[model samples]
Target: MNVNEITPFIGLELSDASYEDLVRPEVWEQLVQGVQERELVVVRGIELTPQQQIDLAARLGEPVPFLISKYRHPEFEQIMISSNEMKDEKPIGVARVGNFWHQDSSFVADPAPYTMLHGVNVPGTSGHTKFANAADVYDRMPEEWKAKLSDRIGLHTVGKRLRIRQEHVGLSVAEFKALIDIEHPKVEHPVVCKDEYTGREYVYGSREYMDSVLGFDPNENEAFFTMLDGLIHDETHVYTHKWTPNDLVIWKTRTTYHIATEVEPGASRTVHRVSIETRRP
Candidate 1:
């Protein structure tokens, strides 16, 4: 079937399902093509062994930048993302924590191009991520909203992006800021970004953080700002992924917004994260 026919089955998946291909041509398959403008593409049910995970990523595209290991495995570059409930990976990670939604590698120049995650150890209680499709969002937005967003250029800073990360890692806000500087133009892209491949558009920007910064003005546009966030949170446009053991999902950072759910006080969710570097920045 053409992509049009398959677009409707996006969020449906069977927890026990497994697949070999990076993207299945089936309706809900993770491998999607045809559009040059879609904001996000989620492939559910790709269970890869640690080695297979690396191989599969290589097949899909080039690998993205990863954090330098103060404490790294022999194959640190290929080491998938991981974490624990109580606290693990000491010395270096004595204070390490779970990751949050922000473009990957924003700490350095030319952050990762895409982020792909695979479930390693998922506690039954809580662990999931929510994604907002920027391309679809822009397509559905009012022309005026689109115009306003287009006219404005945004500033992305490592400091602001890491706010949620700090919170998730259980670090104090003061400590978080102390570790990272709020770098300028962390990514100065448009709020409404289009998918270079699919040519689709979506609203980009961390609403909570962006609005918080726009606290630049004492009189904030709280009401209007919130309404925009509501659009992404709306059931019709949002996809909440409840991860299962062995599930592998890949999304293009350029056109997708994802929130890696931090485990509640009692639960834990762990996964391997890899970023794909693109030819463009």
Candidate 2:
């Protein structure tokens, strides 16, 4: 296998390997190490069937099934790759999912440690995914800032993103929440949390998922979160990935936050996504 560093802190791209090679202990070790060190790792030319994808995910950790029924694959409930490509003048899959910057399932009590996406139909002109190294951002923060956030916690909720998505999809918040079996009450996580595997600390939630910072005046809370958003998303700390067919991306949720960059309306950009539980870490 050949490895290329996409960015200093954010991403790694591995080539010259096939899907069959991934199950090997050595190759799987490399995949795990890549995700641990790089936060986001993308391997090219590994086309996976739904079962193959699920099998690969299981190798890393327990697979978290997609809770949203609209996005779930009809044949395989574990895979959820939605696209704007129409079938009979209606959308077959969800579009612009995770367009906002966030760590997957961070609003929940126990969030997933990793998110894996297998590229199926990548749009030619657009549809890039940008990742930020939250750990790196936290490391560069000033001592004063770190001290202020040392004991701070932020409120996170699915309702935050739900509101934005509902505006575009035309579903009421109650209707939207009712469609998914996942329970997303407002939850709080430390502003900076330590990664169990690496023992390194990273800023946890994002503006998209976090409703507010706890124990601060409203103005102070907004300012702090605004500052956090600016620092964590600064271009220097980010890496943008351009996708190719059969490119599988695995990203560590504890160390990074990611966003789906734009694609044209109705353009096809399908990817099968699954989550690995943080419990093993």
Q: Candidate 2: where is the Cα deviation over 4 Å?
A: 163-183, 278-281
* lDDT assessment of candidate 1: 0.54
Give TM-scores for every candidate, taking all chains together and pairing residue i with residue i. Answer: 0.69, 0.89
Quick one: best TM-score, which candidate? Answer: 2
User: What is candidate 2's lDDT per residue for 161-278, written digit by digit as tens?
Assistant: 6644444387665777665325457888898888776778888878778778798789887877788888877887788788888889998876788888889776778888887874
lDDT of candidate 1 over 1-281, digit per residue (tens) = 11232245133233344444333445333343411234344444556776676665665567743554642223546554456523353432212333344434433445556666777777655667777665655676777766656646555555644435423487676856665544333455555666566555655565533523232343444543565666666666667777767776666665666665667775666677766665443
RMSD of each: 5.8, 3.5
- Which residue window of length 10 is worst by lDDT in model 2? 159-168
lDDT of each: 0.54, 0.81
